[model samples]
Target: MLLLPLHSHGQFQTPLGVAQGQLPQFRAAPPNTPANEPIGGWRILPRLNVVETFSDNVRLQPEALQRSDFVTQINPGLVVTGVGTRYSVNIDYTMNNLIYANLSNFNRIRHQLNAMGTAELIKDFFFVDGRAVMTQQNATLFGAQGVNNINVTGNRQNVNIYNISPYIRYRFQDIATTELRYTRNMVSSSSNALFNSQADAYQASLNSGTAFSTVQWGFNYSHQAVHYERTNRTVEFERSIGNLRYMVTPRFGLTATGGYERNTFLSIRGSPSSPTWTVGFIWEPSQRTSIAFNAGQRFYGDTYSAVATHRTRMTVWDLNYDENITTFNQQAGMSGGFNIGNSLAQLMAAQNPSMSPEAIQQSAQALLGLGLQGSFFDPNNFFSNRLFLQKRLQASVAMNGIRNTFILRGFDMRRKAFSPEGVDSGLIGAGNAALLNNTRQTGVNALWSYRLSQLTRANIDLTYTRFAFLAVDRVDNLGLARVSLVRQLPQLLPNMIGMLEVRHNMRQSNQPGLSYHENAVVGTLSMSF
Candidate 1:
């Protein structure tokens, strides 16, 4: 399976580690640190890539004129393998640009460079495994000609960051495992490091499983303490799992599972964060068909809060079906199903405490005992539909063991936004905050792909969106597209890989005034000893 690990560098994607009733997969390629010692790894490979992009100079809209730009990127990477018994290492240095409308106008020049790696060591006995590891990432960003992009997320300025993490892990009889990790970030920007100082995160996990003649059961727990630049925030959640398995016969078996996670947010004096909940399910009918269902509630905070926690809830379902055309895994086919039940979000309204006594009282009371009834408990409902198909073929030509496969994916989503319209008015306007009625977004997407040879493959996918609301239009006619090719056969190249990839992104605004398109081409070359 292909693994794509994410860094904690500020992302909101929900993770299943705390829900599977199992240990988080503690597998990652480590970077070179503690210079003198040999940081073991599984295998080693170094890579370099270069790309150039040129946008077609076309008019965008009547109000928002058409514009075009050019960009170039250089990516260098290193991957390591075979560590303390078994482990891996990874490193990368990339140069790119940061361009946006609100920041530095259009086609802004930026340079970003990063060097990161990880190392792991482990020992086991009975049914338990003990491990220790460390990871480090250093990044530097510089703007064109030395001018920086004012946007916070822009790597366009003269900024540098170094993150260090050390962790320990233990597994009990393949049923459960836990980890103790500490992470520190050191950043130097145009301003003082006070805002760029160190922060830490604490995480705990537990999992267990029981297997009987015809049944299986499980449970899980996880909690994290996050502190950003000295602000302590508590994040805690737990998940439960239960499953039932049966064998109809020797060739086909069926298994079903149910999972749930509970999240809670405590209101601090400065800013209040809300708690949430999530539920999901998985069903495997046979070797060719599998399905999953997921529903969740999230959050959005009020003003004065640097972050908005939008409490949102929604349900989703998906199914996959595959058909083998050849006994040797030749011709094949697949179909899928998808659906979302509903969605809702909880919105917060902030009041200026410095206002007059009477004004403060009015605003405070209005936002306090606040309870608005609606279909989507939150301000919006995010829904989508999805389907896909796949096909595979064996070599029809040379004796070369080459094979090919293809896939197509389609998706659509609908969304609603209902936010407060501001407090009502009267002699002491203190209690009425109506919700938005005409705010919504919707869109569709299409994807296609092909894999050829024992080491090469390519694919292309695109999306179009439309919105019910003007500003939300782009959010509603368009998405992005990706096309890439990969080829790697170690026995033939002696630990070498050759790859080329291109991606095109296009979007049309719901308002018809805002649209964008971009193209990127990247080539890669790597070798290992």
Candidate 2:
């Protein structure tokens, strides 16, 4: 769901526009643009929020030990954005202070941040990208899951990730183009259960330019070294690949790639290094539809990837399937985080093809402010430090109407650890090693939003997730349903908003002492200046 801008080489580049879909949960979105905004090429907004919540089971514990509590939250936040001919940036930060009426000892403060930007150091050849994210994540899948920071489940931890990359590109007349890039990445966490890691990556690529019409060729090489602080070990990955593309027609192309990979890791199945090969095809029958599929072999076994996207006047559909061997740190740093705003913007753009980008962004922001989007479960990722082979398939459809919007998404993910499990063997200790050995996660989410009036809106969200531990014979099912109403308080103040929500959460587990249910109500008021 993270909105990553694609470059010509089919790689992610730092977006120079607004950061999509990274808004805070359970809060109002950024304020409307004021008349005096963007002073001196910069726009800044300061906001405050007050919230009150009543929950039957604040700790998500079983009925016998459940306790009722009233939670109060006071949050202050800021948003800053700027754009210049040579650079662009976006930053959003919030400080959450939670107070428990009955559980005073649990009062705490949490910081959340999502910032990214890009700059052109040299007009056409040099560029740099920077990003940082601080968010909360479930520490382990075996324990209770909390919907938000209000729950005292003791299963959540703060995770911080940072990345900086700078690259240079040059062209050789009309023959070819080449580029070299270096990236530094860091991942840290507040929990001792997860390891802190740093990585250095170097990459180089050369591709045929417009000189090659029927046949196009490319060569790429990359090397990465990651250091885990917890285990004081360094893992390295190196790859070299050559690829060719044959254009059969204006809308169809055949592709093939041959590569060799080398890695330093303890593998249980076979050698960690192997020769990789893949064959695939890309087809674009129309301007609104595209499909790509590839099948290959790696060290572990066979691998496959498929992507299909189609958009109509009022609807957008996407389906993807991919398999890869990676660690948790790598996934976190590479994908950034999911953004609902970005997804909404895409749907809106598809619905109104003539809308300008700036107008679409504003509309997306307004919809987000009205709480039309809800956080959905991501089955492809979880808390783990060991290296694993993951295969995931996800599909989604979004439809936009004159006064209503609907989104439905589903995903199936499977993971198996290939590295040894132990304190000295891998990133985690043996006690919790089995948790990630073999697992499957499947989930579906549906959201419906209705615009009752220009200033009022309503939303209903439902989600269900099932987690199965293949190695430990444990299965857990979680479900949530929520209904909310949001109103823009122009009468009170142009930049003020109010929301009321009611939700129910339940968990059904085959393991004893893990089943629970809770109902909650939340009211929030937000104002921006």
lDDT per residue for candidate 1 within 278-300, as digits (tens), equals: 34444445543344443443333
Each model's total of backbone clashes: 40, 3
RMSD of candidate 1 to the truth, in angstroms, is 19.4
Mark the regions of model 2 whose C-alpha exceeds 4 Å error after superposition. 1-37, 337-343, 350-376, 424-431
Candidate lDDT (C-alpha), each:
0.30, 0.75
How high is each candidate's TM-score?
0.43, 0.89
Model 1: how far residue 257 lies from native, Å: 10
Tens-digit lDDT string for candidate 2 (229-281) = 85768989999999999999989999999999999987887898999999999
lDDT of 2 at 462: 87
* Candidate 1's TM-score: 0.43
Model 1: lowest-lDDT 10 consecutive positions: 325-334
| Leading candidate by TM-score | 2
Worst 10 residues of 2 by lDDT: 5-14
